[model samples]
Target chain A: MNNAANIAVDIAIILVLIAGISRFRTPAGARFGNAMAALALLFAVAVALYRNPMLSSNATLAAFALAASSLAAWRVSAKINMTRIPSLVAFQNGAGGLAALLVAIVEMSGAGPAPGAVASAAAAVSVSLGAATFSGSMIASLKLSGKIRQTPTVVPGHNIALLFLSAACAAAAALLFAPGDPTSALVSLAFLSLAFGALFSIRIGGADMPVLISFLNAATGMAAAFCGIVIQNRLLIACGAVVASSGFILTMVMCRAMNRSLMNIIVGGKAPARPPASSPATASSPELTAAPPAPVAASQPEQPAADPLSLAADALRAAKKLIVIPGYGMAIAQAQSETVALAGMLEQAGTEVKYAVHPVAGRMPGHMHVLLAEADVDYDKLFEMDDINAEFAETDVALIVGACDVVNPAAKEKEGTPISGMPVLNAGDARSVIVCNFDDKPGYSGVPNPLYERPNAILLFGDAKATLASLIAKLK
Target chain B: MSDLLVMLVVFTASSAIGYVMISKVPQRLHTPLMSMTNAISASTIIAALLLFSSKLDSPHKVLAAAAVALAAFNVIGGFTVTGRMLKMFKKQ
Candidate 1:
């Protein structure tokens, strides 16, 4: 009967995972996926209760723990804003890591002097990876939440320090299976892993955060798998494997999007410094003061700045087909609604409008999609970079709404530049380009965008939300 | 097969399956993908609960209980958030 229950639980989990995967292809699959997940969790809890002898004896305490934790988690989920979902993910990943670390601590403390080699080794890995994930994810959360500075904090010789710490962790793990007292060695391993996690994550810049977060999520999953191996749990191993592989795939996708190797990210380089703030002529625009100062080498020679609102309005009036490109700037200015409004007006005027989204456009993966989704933008009109790149040449006007780096022409023009090989939207290929950005400050890569200076491109300098509003008014 | 070998097979096979399964997901669902995986990982709560309910002493029991709490937090928080995020993506 117990064996049957265990098998049932395993089958339920596998079904849940299958349902989750099916969500991508089927419109109704998400709802089904959540229901299956809940059922799986219930079955798992039941099996856990049945198999553990102590649960019957200490039922109250165990029930209390489960109830309290679930309530707290539910409250957190209820309160978190959609915009801060990434930070919430980071926190949950950290909590998972902490759970694994606690399991390792429990096992280590209970192990006799002559614990088996397998158990010791598993425990060691569990502790090390768990501690690393826990601390690293906490730092990632802080960076995402604006609690810590968002830029990469590269300490001199960070790689060497990480290498040294890794060596220490390995040595401590080896000591766990050796003859002497393993307790002190385990403690040292945990400390080193925690320190390594902090040091490793602090050096990663904002541009690489998606990769780092995915990588850490994978690491935490593997650590949980190791904890399963130590405790001889089949369910954990299965779930952990799924999470690890999924996270690994996401990490690779993010890396490919950035056109950077995982090795390059691990080696820890600094993002180029942002240029000094550029003061815009329009003092009424509050976002100008908030925009990063333009570097001294302002690429665009101030062509008696044209009235961008009128220029954009005229272009829209004449345009037959328009493509909208949005990036981190749109998210920063909270302009998705305004962007959608502008698109609506353009559509009403008989101009065909479409949105082109770069893979790594915003602060996180799929950020622009979510923001636009919130504004009720039709999903059919949204196009990925590859799908939309070919249409740029025929596009009458490519309206870049606060997007800079992704539309920069320098990626194709120059060699030895930061974003040389990165796949960017072909916004520059359009007959006319209008950049609705606060200033000419370079993007996270800190490379000057030559697209702004192109003859076909006109800069609409102001806050994206306000500028789009004005553009809409002018169009009317 | 030894217990370890059986586990190794499960781990390897699940990982391969997971890679294929996750790869099919569209880029737009990446955030929900992450949170759902997190929810699955909370299966470790079973191990924690079993440990806590064992005949261990006070300190070990406390640690095991803490593990249960943390894992429970991941499970509940992860699923709830994933559901909320997915609701936003429903056809409107």
Candidate 2:
């Protein structure tokens, strides 16, 4: 095939792959896919560079190898349950950054003192950025994977140190441009890059892993694309640009979900002040946990579904205040659309409906938010843990949809529990609690919610999506 | 031409399949998926480092050995970390 056709085909393939990969919430298996993509692109580039048509055979072979690996990975992943996938993901991201850095190093060392000033300078920038991302990602991965501490590890004057390193890298770049030895300049830049990466990782806390990972991913891609520009490879340029742009957007979305700024993650400081406890008396209260078992489960139809529905219908028909509490079960059932529809029904009935998002609602952070966003829920209706906590009491009807842990009063009132320190939604504090859960199974933390046993709490047992859709149908 | 086409077809198909496999995965699997990916990544790094360092020829054997060392680090460290993650699910 001709170079132009190959370039076009390669670019198209890479763009599709990037789009497909980005569809993942946390992008599981992205690194494996990325590595394969890199290898394929590398082969194509080497063939073009050597101008050897026969190298096409090698490219085919490499492609086959990548395919085989991906399939094997898929099959193995399907079998054994692996819990450390995030840590592994972090590791692969670090490795990708490392790969980019090494590629830059190889290019710089081999090119020597190229007479083309513009090309050389661009290459140096790519190398420096690549090196920084490589080391920084490694540290971030370690931090996330619990190989290192999640607390602040930044020394005094850490920002000052970063500023100094940036200055040195700039100075080194200038020296290289002034007909100085490229080797020395490259080496100096490498050191600066390493130092910069360390400081950057130290500044970030564990809470911001998702944001940091995405940001570092973008940095790595930019570096690779810059290297591509240096080497004049159109395919590399296209692929790298795609990865970098998507990574940045993902980072932004993750930060926004936490109601945090990207700058806060970078500079790193204290999180929001936690609310002080009221008193031990409130914490030790037994009224919250002593209600009958029928309220907690499908133990009995305590006044039947028709009665609660009539009450909910009355609340839907009469009130202006309605809050929907979504949980992991909602995510598991993929019930965001149904929940949205239910909320829409309530809103149409003149009830102001809002989603009360509990911090650590689902399996990972922002799990419910991501699902809701996928189902086209309005971004404004989703409230954070603190923002929506106070309003729960004023809510005329708290529609607890497929939630267990976050709404559990046990987290707040019961001392010496597993998740006692973890703040949960005050759904029980509302005028009435209507719970839609699957069964009597405890939550991920392996504890039963006393809020489930409340006399005011109505239990509806069924599939989350089906139940919500049914409820929405009834409301309509 | 056939070779290039073969590569493209294979990779696309594999990724599609991987997407399916990844879709059904529970949160319990997140840590394991991460560990496996890390293992593969570390392997790639070692391979690349070895290939580059070997090109230098000076202490080429040492470079190859170092590459193997990195691979070992990835495997052992990867598994250890993975085990710890799995331990979270043991009882609680």
Candidate 3:
């Protein structure tokens, strides 16, 4: 295909990808769609580059390069667990930045001196921005991946140094492209830029790397866009623009997840507080080694001797305001449909129903949101932690289905616990708390919850799907 | 081209090493590790900028300069941020 046709195909594929990943807040058919779109993009790249005379001349080398980069990306995506996700994202940003830097270099180095002053300026900005983002992203990835300590590695007067470097870079850029000694001035600009990138990244903390990665991703996209304008490449322009917009959106989402601002993270500010150290005395529990307990609380909450049927009947009869808290276990059990059915039954019985969402409830962010969305839960019914915490006071029954960490009162009551400062759902505040899970083990943060011992909390220990299904049948 | 290959190999190897270390280290080490990686990225910027000088008035120089600036930002800013975060741990 020719350039125009190639542009059309690329745009179409990109649109499909964008549409697929657009609903960032929920789990939908989007991930699958994105995978398919990625495949299509690969095909398009193959066709476009293969058809181009310049690229086609060294087809084998180009193919190898493309394959290597794609494989690197795929490996990172597939292998990165939650803890390593920030690093992988940072690496991806670096890749994008590197690509933009390459584009700018190719354009600026080969262009005639008269490619217009505007193009030169665009080229300069692209080169500088791309380099900064590339290095910054790599640093962020390294920090998040645990290759470096999550602390400031700066010398004194870092801000003043940055200001000077910025001034020098601008001066150098102007001189390099002027009537005299362009080469020497450009060389100096390169040196100052290098110092700037290193100094900028060495000052941030590790916990903030996620936000940094997001911001750098946006920066890399902007660099690519600038490079595209320098080279007059429509396809690059669109790709860069999409990446820039999506990066911004994702950055905003990440900030919300961390309860932080983009500027604060970028400016090298600290987190609000340190994560409390793991409690050595209470850290390891016998629950991890031994058989898990049954549905009743072992401590404070006394179990009624009623059978499952009687318990279900009581729940159906007594529940006037009911809330369901979903977790990773719900996703693992695929109990969303059954839970929704149970909710529907309770609603018909005149019990008000809602879902409480804790920010970091699941294996990944939005884990519960994805499962519930699959069951066609209304978006408006999902309440964020702060909004839902107050509702627990008037709640008649809080059915915490497969949730652990998010509902654990340990976040507030227990000092020096792993997740002490993290926010948690106030399920224990409800009149009745019913926890359904297969095990008594604490969650990823490794903290035992006091919510389990609450006066009204009941441990409905069983297969979550089976329990929910039975509850739905009983309610009907 | 050979230098680029070397940088790629170094990064790839460093990434592999990082993955192995993440699960083993204490959480307190996270910032310092990140700082080291930031330095490596700065190195990449330096190499790219040097290449830019050779390309002179060509379009490739622009790309090299961008890479250098980004690396500078990451290294300098990352250290400052990490220092502040570490203070929280120290105070407690």
Candidate 4:
């Protein structure tokens, strides 16, 4: 195919991919859109093969690789539970990065003609980025899947180490233009970049995973685009750029949702060092293994004689309007089904129920929606923070399940805190509040929740599943 | 030189268009959209495949084949999982 024809075909395939992404305006359309995207990728692969046919042996190898990987991926994706989607997505992203890494390595060390200065630089960058993304993504997946501590761990001179590694990577990349074969330089560069990625991500954790993952998503896309430049493939370049931009936008959106800057997350992680002194959170529960039976109310002038669960049940049963807020803890407790079951019961009892979803509620952007959808909750009931913030005021009960930070009124009334400027669901405005959290401890941000101390609030602090299970019996 | 310039133009134009279109997608679909884009990023599969169109040693060939496998895995896994997640959404 001539250059113009190749461009035309690439454009056509990209348009098809765009058509697929455009379907994301709704969930039903997104399913079709996902299929369209897959189809477009297949078209690109087929066209490339036709344009440049491989020898027989190479063809056999490619076929085997395709079949084996496709079968493995299909099996895992088809059977995996929805709650684990974030870690799965991270793992897949790392695979893409690994591909880019290998391709860049081959380009750099191939017996083919040496590349020009620009192409060589691009190749070096692609290798480093790809390796970095792979390592960083693996760490993030480990954290998300609970293989590592969810809190940010900062080593001494962590920032300094990151800077030094970045400089070393750049220095090693420059060595790619040296006289001998680029093998040594490539290895050093890839190693430095991998360390850089691991270091960059280790200081980010808890509620910050959304931004970190999204940022890594952008980095991997960028690596692919740079790889395209080295190989002179327009299709790879275009798709890489598209993914890069999409990930970048999501990163920015997540930062804005938390009223934070990207720099703050990557550098100034877990800023407050400790929860505020005014907090009455001394009665904290640390272990999830032991399920506590009673719900401890924070800061009541006189402790109510009745059981907190019964009080919460009474409020829920009498509620004319209810809003349910879900968080990452909900996913940890796997209380999605129980929560949905209770919501259904409330709905059947004539209480209008809605869900208020904070953008940073789950591990990723829109993660809670996926979990709730898996539990058979209607998508229409999910409302974004801005859309449902005001409704909390007029509602009869704000039933919070495994959520914090998002409902903490301290975000509004405090300053100089990690989540000070963050926008929170106004669950505190509701007439009555029932908090079904894992504990009375400060949330992921380590900021004490004043909502737990509200006069009308009832804290059912325990395993969210058991708490909801007992509450589910309230209506029965 | 002109080819490089043209490719740059294509990259910038597509990125701009993707940004605009992706911004239109509601938060409800962010997970599926991101996973779908993850699949699309594996377009390096073309470049990985092209690695074999030229001559190479056995080690290079093995590396190239590994690239092909990883890219294929990314594309297939990302899209399949995204499809499953999207299927779970219901309007009612």
Give me the candidate number with maximum lDDT: 4
Q: Is the docking of candidate 2 incorrect, acceptable, medium or high quality?
A: incorrect
Q: Each candidate's fnat, in order?
A: 0.62, 0.02, 0.03, 0.86
Full ranking by TM-score: 4, 1, 3, 2
Interface DockQ per candidate? 0.66, 0.05, 0.04, 0.86
TM-score of chain A of each: 0.88, 0.56, 0.60, 0.94
Docking class of 4: high
Ranking by DockQ: 4, 1, 2, 3
Candidate 2 local lDDT, residue A279: 45
Candidate 3, residues A318-419, lDDT tens digits: the string is 899999998767766768788888887778878898999765454223445545654667756777777779999998888888888678788778876655
TM-score of 1: 0.90
Tens digits of per-residue lDDT for model 4, A69-177: 8899889889998889899889999999989999999988999887888788888879998999999899899999999997888999998999999899989998999
Residue A470 C-alpha lDDT in model 3: 71
Largest TM-score belongs to which candidate?
A: 4
i-RMS, every candidate?
1.8, 11.6, 16.3, 0.9
Structure candidate 1, residue pairs in collision:
A276-A293, A276-A294, A277-A293, A277-A294, A278-A293, A278-A294
- Full candidate order by lDDT, most accurate first: 4, 1, 2, 3
Off by over 4 Å in 1: A1-12, A111-114, A179-181, A271-306, B90-92
Better of 1 and 2 by TM-score: 1
RMSD of each candidate relative to the true structure:
4.5, 12.8, 14.0, 3.2
User: Whole-model lDDT, candidate 2?
Assistant: 0.56
Q: How many angstroms is residue A327 displaced in model 2 relative to the true structure, after the best TM-score fit? A: 8.9
